[model samples]
Target: MAKTWFITGASKGFGREWAEAALERGDSVVGTARNPDDVQALVDQYPDTFLAIRLDVTDRAADVAAVQQAAEHFGRLDVVVNNAGFGHFGMVEELTEDEVRAQLETNFFGALWVTQAALPIMREQGSGHVVQVSSIGGISAFPTVGAYHASKWALEGLSQSLSQEVAGFGIHVTLVEPGGFSTDWSGPSSKHSEELDAYADVREAASKRPSASDPGKPEATRSAILKVVDAEQPPLRVFFGKAPLGIAERDYESRLATWREWQPVAEEAHGA
Candidate 1:
């Protein structure tokens, strides 16, 4: 059966790839981008199968309205992809409060609001999938992207809890943690703080990291996502890319070691 998908940030990158894949498979897509013109090409191509809408994910009201609009247009929404977010690069001290807030607004709260809006519709229909596009940084922090990591970490926690909360209603939640993908996430879509000489080493290391033109392929991501959407029961958390899986394993191992090393201290805190 063909599904109806509502995808945010569908103008480019993984979001665009997902939208294209759905349309090619005979599914209809309600694709949203901040600049409608960015997705005009898709509208021209998919015509009857695609509806391009202008949206700023940070606006809760607008997000809710967009969700409703999409559902009404397609008569149903089978999947919702919260893929509208940008990367913020800078040392913790270098980022302004406003910068951090802006990142959280779009990456964390934006998804939260969209989920909130979509849940009711899904609940009424008794089925739907919500895909949250996080990053490997959500599970492990790196130098220079503290704000971005914080936002994704919050999103991970939110999505995990949401998956449990909505299971009774037949709504599934998926958290996608992608590593070095060939997306504009690290290029035109990314934001950077003012350079500080004190953080030269951090900046230098970050500079060597891969960019949007790197080895990762968006098509692979799209295919993986489609598989997840088609599955009878999708995973709670899915990691993409070789680097992300390796990093996640190392992070969990380090966390286990730290927990064991601090077990005595943790036990003592019980006041036995």
Candidate 2:
């Protein structure tokens, strides 16, 4: 079957790659960006199968309208990819209130609104997939990008609950957690906080971290995404690169050890 995809941030990076992959494989896509002109090339390339439109995902009403337009145009929406997000570089203390809110507005609330918009349609049709483009940062903490991590972590939690809630409606939700990808995420699309002299050492050490090396190719993930959306039972969470599993394993191991160590304390708190 030729599935229909509604992808946010389809102008560049993973969203563009995924949109092209689906269109190449004979699927239809309504690709949205803040500037529809940015994705005009894709529309020109796949004239029949691609529709490029303007959408700033942070606007809840705009999210609803875009999803409705997509469903109406294609007659169905089989996949909704919330891939429109950017990295915000700031220490926890260094982050501004407005910065945090803006980050959540796009990375967290944007996906929330889009998912809310699509759920009704998917439930009525009894089939759909919602792919959240989270990062390995969602699972682990880093020095300079705390806000980005918080956004992804919140997204992870939301999608986890959403997966269970929508399963009965034949909707599959997948969190695509990628490692460092060779994309504009940390480049043109990224925002940085005002550098503080006190955090210079922390910033320096973070920049030298081993995990920052060997960025995955953005185009390489196209096939993986294709298989995921095409699956009979897609995973609730999946990693797009090798780094995430090791990161998760280490993070979980440390978390489990700490939880077990505090088990007695936790139990004592329940005294009747």
Highest lDDT against the true fold, candidate: 2
Point out where model 1 deviates above 4 Å.
209-214
Local distance difference test, candidate 1: 0.92
Error of 2 at 174 (Å): 0.3
Q: Supply the TM-score for candidate 1.
A: 0.97
The estimated TM-scores of all candidates read: 0.97, 0.98
lDDT of 1 by residue, 1-272 (tens): 99999999998998999999999999999999999999999899889999998999999999999999999999998999999999998899999999999999999999999999999999999999999999899999888899999999999998999999999999999998888877788799999999899989877876786543355788887788889999999988998887887777888999999999999999999896
Question: What is the per-residue lDDT of model 2 for residues 47-147, given as tens digits with 9 covering 90 to 100?
Answer: 98999889999999999999999999989999999999999998888899999999999999999999999999999999999999998888888899999
Candidate 2 residue pairs in backbone clash: none
Candidate 1: lDDT of 10? Answer: 95
